[model samples]
Target: MRKIGGLLLCCFLLNGLNGQHQVKTRKELQREVIRCINESAQQYKVMMQRLDAARFPVTWYAKEDKLVTSGSEPWVGGFYPGALLYLFEYTKDSALYKEALQKLNVLAKEQYNKTTHDLGFMMYCSFGNANRLAPKPEYKTILINSARSLASRFNEKVGCIRSWDSDPGRFMVIIDNMMNLELLFEATRMTGDSSFYRIAVAHANTTMRHHFRPDYSSYHLVIYNPANGSVLKKQTVQGAADSSAWARGQAWGLYGYTMAYRETRDPKYLEQARHIARFLLQHLRLPADKIPYWDFDAPGIPDAPRDVSAGAVICSALLELATYTPLKESKGYMKAAEKMLQSLCSPAYRATIGGNGGFLLKHGVGNYPRKADIDVPLIYADYYYTEALQRYRKLGMKR
Candidate 1:
């Protein structure tokens, strides 16, 4: 009778928990979530005051015409200002929204800022999502214009999106393009012309061909025959190019394809996403604590340090995969995600002290050549870290 009563009590608790999301509209739930987001966003604003905006163009580094360093990132700017727009969206704070729009519009006019790798991160992170959530026709116009600007970067010869913002023929493509394609796809949907979607699909298909090896681990960069569109070399373009596997690059593919499948509903994209997920789980070395190295193939971990940012990205991706994946496979992905979230929430990966910036993750390497922000803080790390938490908490409870 005691054991039976315990099981009944558990069932009662579970049912009530599952009811929260079902009963709330997206707007209503987001209202509550925004309360939490604002606390972090306010802290983030204060920290960002330190950055020198002119020098630290965020995301990827650019070419410097000097010898001591082949390239120079030289400073620290990142993609989080756009993320602030989310707080604005949820709160309807006109000031916050306007400030973010101003920043992106200014960035749009920046002639030097032209990397295509993070079109979504740079543009869609604010303006694109703004257009979707708010539906302002004028912002819609800006979003369309941004799409055209992004489409202009597509290399017809390579059939891929160009990245790294360097020389024209030194073409390089990376896994992060999957997120950028959504910008392009949405542009097509918004404009009712197929051209933007066509470019996005072409880039996605091209990546499926050139980036993945037979075993399914990916190359970070592929240089193409710019003149003829032949892939000249498939190199481990980042993280020790000598056959080392980058953990975040792997996560990008896992999440990217899952996202691709969500958009295109193509089985091949889902399979590729699964292939990478299976490889990571099967080989992931769960130390005493469960976070991962920046690179799985990187020698000397625990002592060398691990990247919580990668784990956070993968955790959210796996959870999304769990929702859409077959039931049997879903269990494993959710389990891995649980482990990652547990690791991130722990004292090891999380930022404990105050005023160090609002970023939740530690040990995220931007380019590594640029700086070693060892276990420091990163904005995207915090964004995805919080996302994984919210997703995990609301797993079966959500719409």
Candidate 2:
């Protein structure tokens, strides 16, 4: 009788939480998302009117009130184009598609860039989306080569891809590196190259073993001994402290593991994703709006800057997770994701039609510690926000 009572209590609690939050219907959300995308397309058109092909946007500088752009090799170069592709997919606007292709043309040279571990961000996000939409032969070749470049960074000794080389002596693997595995997985699917799949699995397994706390909150970076495969330090570069949960880092882990599960059908990966989601959702510090503070443990509680990029990422991942889980397990995830989408569509986070420097979402905390791109509009935030809308649209269509 006690066990049966506990189950009933659990169901009651879940129902209460779901009932307390009222989200927009699919039709309402679709209209709002489409309006936002149309506004974003127009904003980009104005911004791109003066942009040189050699530069790509990274974030908006509110103090300067201008778009911050970088060269072709920056990790964030692909996101602008990726967001454009999402807009194109949704609006079927030829201008958006043309601009995205132009940016991808400029971004194509990064396929051979082996100096960095971000080829996935630089190449795959751009070309991979292009291939999915257009199915061009050249895009596949670009992605396959980009995967090869990313694979070149893998060290068997550390059982992970090297994320940074700044320290020279230390082999660094970051939680953010988890986001890159999608490129490798896609490569295996495109070319039947099991090597890419193996490398991705090795990295995911190694990360799962070391990068997470018992509670499943992830550290930002893990430094390993390059020669002996020994962990030297587990630290955070962008989080509040070495021990705190960085909002974006956790989001990356959730999204990455969710993607990993989809690609490999690994139960461990799914469990990990669910665990991380629980940590994020159940944390007391999470704001009522479904967006998180820059760090879960960051000082100032309600005063800390919200990371819309993190929220956008989690929103997209949860929508995908909803499709994969059982109905009972999926209800909360879907509701939470819908709430996030509603929050993002609100005036507080979503930029006005002509504002926010051509970005879709506003007020993302890029790296609070580094004092970089704080409380500004970010390209990746827009990319993932649009991606989430696309996913939600597909789900609604299925219904």
Candidate 3:
């Protein structure tokens, strides 16, 4: 409770400082922050009421039609709780926290919904991260056990987290595994278990070995045999399978490595991040305005589809990279970050058509198999953009 109070207070201090005169003293900033959090709490309360009234459950939706805010059904493992956790972060309301916790409790117990590739976004985003910042026993047990379950899915011979239930008996990895590795890592920390962390590092090392191309751009799918730790195949699970780069896959690589670097301070992870960032920047035809198309070298150029989610995610990665880089590299990455942020904040990419939905960018294509959300707003894009905006405000042109 005290931690939550502190968080809410910090939030107030953060927002309260905004839209006000330049503050010459820390005291003034502190005062403004408290006021802001209080005001924000009220707004969050109203939002919670509206959100709940709509019946939004915190679960991943595999298809567009399943995205209705409320009810009993679940799409995948990550969606619903992830949204609620974000809301709880803003509000610091116990009710929201408990509600989200309750959902996680249920998902943790449900044995059947555990086979997907989204463990990080599903478990970590919903509870693991929260546990790091705020410890709750039920929340902790559920998240750790959930991480263990995901870890169990790892085929020791493959050296990677398995993906795609269709290949049920087989072990394969996807580019998205990078994000979920955090679950394993955090689970290890929470449980004092070496097996979990070891598995995570092995998966990451294996990914580095096979998934990335000579240019540092990555393939979307890699088949590995857990029995002997050999890669059977590496392929693109999305995009034109002829080795075409999926822009979001590239973003995942960038963000994921940067995250790995943050966790281990490994030079290889940092180097990989730089290599991928360079490939993305140099090859991607980012305009003076700066958002990128769905692929860096997407065929058909101007007519190619755009994935604003990539731009938002890459911006977040670049900023984190800048934090540890040398001055020159940091400045360059910072400038790129600003460019991407401007691209999203600009009229061209953002959606004004939504009915009070906070989705910042449209055109995130998940699997063309579900062609429902083409050219429409995505929730994560908005979440990441908001995170970037908050960071930008705090750091003040950090480059």
Candidate 4:
């Protein structure tokens, strides 16, 4: 009877949640953004003491009472410094800047690391913002070299940047590769070298052709024959099945194409981004709060774990997409993003002060299928949540 009663109550609450629509005005969002940023500043100051200069934060494992960390070479290394820079940008706290600079010092050597396709995440997010706020010749040089290292992964025959180095015969590209193109695009802008721009375009074009489904949902991974550039398999490692739409994969596509449109003024990328947004917004199972299940097609409906990281990424993308779209669509996009931010700020998702291992948000699913970092606080989740808050405040509530 107890188990049955619990199940009934859970369903009832979810149904009520689905029926509710919460909205926040620009002023309300501004206040929350300030509060969140200030909280982040305090939390990260504590987090800085938990790790030394050589390692970066990954997530906070509350159950273990541990702060999980990674080296500077992984894909997530930059987000620590990137988050610090974002916090520093808003707070102008010398401690935030000093901590970010320390992480960047440890991370700068990744510019020459040609072994991975994640230098964009590792270098650009850290140094790109650093260069933007405080331009340094060395930063520019590091970014250019990082872009060169990333560009070297592109295959002329495949018309895409190889994402993962596979066994002797296969080339693997994941939809996440789209996020890396911004580095290439920025490199071209910085160097006036059309080669980098051309590579970015080719990679985007090829991914558009192969990575997405008819409905704009993307495959997590597509494997190709290295010699002939022909696709051999389409599958997923993080989703429930080979064909299920992983929540974060969709978020990456939406953000990548929106960014592509911003850089190139290309109508197709805009259309692609809009399509992805619609798919996510209109999906039958998407919760009313806008935080989606780890996989859209996961077997457990209304009970699957929510990926707050995906929500943060999508919220940030939608805020940017709202600007470039038509007024009617833009209004919808902005309102949706506002709702997402509100949900993220609520006590259900946002961590309490001095809690969550010094991270800002909670309930992030890094790789659900792999049973890794499940329902934890992720560094990228906080980074993108901070980014979305910044973007929302900048847009304001003029409409």
Best TM-score among the predictions, by candidate number = 4
In order, candidate lDDTs are 0.63, 0.87, 0.64, 0.88
* Candidate 3 C-alpha lDDT tens digits along 1-399: 995565356334423422332323334433433443334334334435445432443212333324335342233344445545554565577875665665666556532346665767666766664565578887777777667777767766677777776765556788877987877777777778889888888888889999988988899888766568777777876765638778888898999999898877889999999999899888746544456666666665554556767787898889889887999998889878876765565445554432224233545555532454444555556556645655555565342
- Candidate 2: lDDT over CA atoms? 0.87
> TM-score per candidate, in order?
0.77, 0.93, 0.76, 0.95
What is candidate 3's CA lDDT for residue 258?
Answer: 92
Candidate 1's error at 280, in angstroms? Answer: 1.4
What's model 2's lDDT at 280?
92
Worst 10 residues of 2 by lDDT: 10-19
RMSD of 2: 8.2
Ranking by lDDT: 4, 2, 3, 1
Can you list the residue pairs that collide in candidate 1?
363-375
- 1-399, model 1: which lDDT tens digit per residue? 995565356334423432331333434444434444555556545444533433222221112211111111221112454555655544566655655555555554421334445656556655665566667876667667767767877889889878756766678787777767777777787889899988988888899998887778788888886788997777765564547677778878888888888877889888988998888888755443445666777655434446666787888899889988878888878767766665565444555433444454555665542434544455567666656655654664574
Tell me, what's the RMSD of every candidate?
10.7, 8.2, 9.9, 2.4
- The list of candidate 3 runs beyond 4 A from truth reads 1-113, 352-358, 369-372, 397-399
Among the numbered candidates, top lDDT falls to 4
The Cα error of candidate 1 at residue 104, in Å, is 4.3
Q: Write the per-residue lDDT of candidate 4 for residues 1-399, one digit (tens) a residue.
A: 995575456445644665664566778777987888888789888888788779899998876799998888889988988889988888899999999998899998999999899888888889998998899999999999999999999899888888887564788999999999999999998999999999999999989999899999999999888788899999987899988999999999999999999999999999999999999999998888888888999876787778889999999999999989899999899888888898888876888877898888888899987789887899999989888877776676553
Cα displacement (angstroms), candidate 4, residue 81, comes to 0.6
Which stretch of 10 consecutive residues in model 3 shows the poorest summed lDDT? 14-23
- Model 4: colliding residue pairs: none
